[model samples]
Target: MSLLPNTMRAVAATGSVPLDDERALADVDLPLPELRPRDVLVEVAAVSVNPVDVKTRMRRPADAPRIVLGYDAAGTVVGVGSEVTLFAPGDEVYHAGVITRQGTNAEFHAVDERLVGRKPANLSMAEAAAMPLTTITAWESLFDRFRLDASSGGTLLAVAAAGGVGSILTQLAATLTGVSVIGTASRPETRDWVRGMGAAHVVDHHGDLAAAVREIAPDGIDRVFTPSTAGRLPLYADVLRPFGEIVAIDEDPDMDARVLKSKSIAWLWESMFTRGVFETPDMIRQHELLDEASAMFEDGRLRSTLAREIAGIDAAGLREAHALVASGRSIGKVVLVR
Candidate 1:
């Protein structure tokens, strides 16, 4: 009954290399669904490249020579494993995958029912493709990492707000929490984008971030949500209020973060894949978060971060997108549309 190929085309990492200076993709054959009882076979139409994809592919686990390379995806379900209750054949869905599994940089993918969510009705596959990775990261940082309460008033700053997760996180802070949002974007256009997404203010990350934030908030920032680990510690130290929290989702070994202790500030690192990787008792929390996010999108409280759409689901396109993201110049999420 499946009208799908047995072997899917995936962009694989032939060898390891640094994302900035090397070729990570070498096209290859990846085994398609042979289906599990609770899986959904999705025909991927659009996918987004994240830093994780760039890093994992660049570090090609020499042992496993055929790892597919994407996480965020938007597609239509083509086949349903017997016990799939939330979706059926012909449903449109989007999700960021489990870190331990094969990814969405393929023609087709098989995923668990618990990890997928309905694509936003107002968005295209490319638009919806941008939400999952950002959503998961922001949600984890705000609610879990910082332990901020939605009913309490707080002030937060997002360093590098024009990036993928920061864009969405800005809006999430506005609508979900009782927090005043100050987003940092150096460029004029990016600053506008951050403010349009409901940020109370936009500070230039190019200037002294601490100084810019102080000119605007004068007192101090209660929390700093950083989607990048680049240049965070030094810039934030001066503006963080006592007991302020800092959360970063990027993988950077350069961060010691211990200096924050002098101010009684807390530093937190977030990774959404933690639930799926370890099958945490709250493994199903993603399902709940996606449901809530969907409602936010439906109610007009949340917006898609999709910025650029690249055609084709091939190695060349992915390489280009990865290069841009690795370059640290992109203003928002980029999607590879099939």
Candidate 2:
């Protein structure tokens, strides 16, 4: 009764190595994943590499089984579990798969239905694949974590605005809301890319972030969103207004919250995997936000941030993508087409 294949090729991490080392990535044959009660089996058409894939692989145990490494993916639904109701066979969809499970680099991937959304009709599979992880991170950061009102006008400083998540965050903040977004980039090409994403102001984070931002907005920034918060905690404290909100997706244990003590700034972490990882009561929120993003993309309010495209979906392609991301110079997202 099922048309699904028994095995497929997947780009997996063979062992820990330098980011650009091709020997660390391999194209391996794997058995198809079993579907959970709320799962959908997706025949992957395209997938994008995120920094998480690179970071996770770097710290992976040497003797651990080869692990597939991808999160943002677009594909067609070929099968569904018993409890799946949101999608049917043949439906085109996209999702940022959960962190705990095997990922989306394989030919076929099994993902929870609640974390999947209909693909934007206007975008290609590769373009669609570039969105999920960054879109979800940006959406959740703006609405859920910071809880900023769309109608309220304030300055927002986005650090590393040329990167995957920051690019989308800049676009979302500038287009969907009244926020004045200031993006930080260290390179000319990336600065242009950030400005092209609709950032009102682009400044160099390698220089004085606070001074450059203050030049544009005499008043201090009301919110700050960044992927890294390691050594920049004190900078955030200086740039943010009193009682402002600061949200980051990366984990930095060295960051001391007391740095913002005088300003009473609110610090929060936005992990897109929280709902899927914990199976919380509001797990369906990812579905809701993703659907909204699809609609926005269809209506032309939002555009795909896919900047680089690779030809293959094999080990070599995976290594190339990981190397690009590690360079920290990618303007937007790097997607590998099947």
* Local accuracy by lDDT, each model: 0.82, 0.90
Runs in model 2 deviating more than 4 A are 20-23
Q: Write the per-residue lDDT of candidate 1 for residues 1-338, one digit (tens) a residue.
A: 45566687878765466443334576777778566786888899999988777677667654456667688999999998889899988889988878888789899888887788888787889988988878988888888897766795778888788888888888888887889998888878898999988899888877777777888888888888876666578667778888888887865677777778889988788998988778788776886787789888888999888888899888888888988888888888989999
What value of lDDT does candidate 2 attain over all alpha carbons? 0.90
lDDT of 2 at 77: 94
| Candidate 2 lDDT by residue in tens digits, 1-338 | 16777899997896677655665888889999999999999999999999999889988877778788789899999999999999999999999989999999999999999999999999999999999999999999998887766686888899899899998898889877899999999888989999999999999998988899889877688999988788999989888989999999898878788999999999998999999999999998898889999999999988999999998888888888888998887889999999
Per lDDT, the best of the predicted structures is 2
Give per-candidate clash totals.
Answer: 0, 0
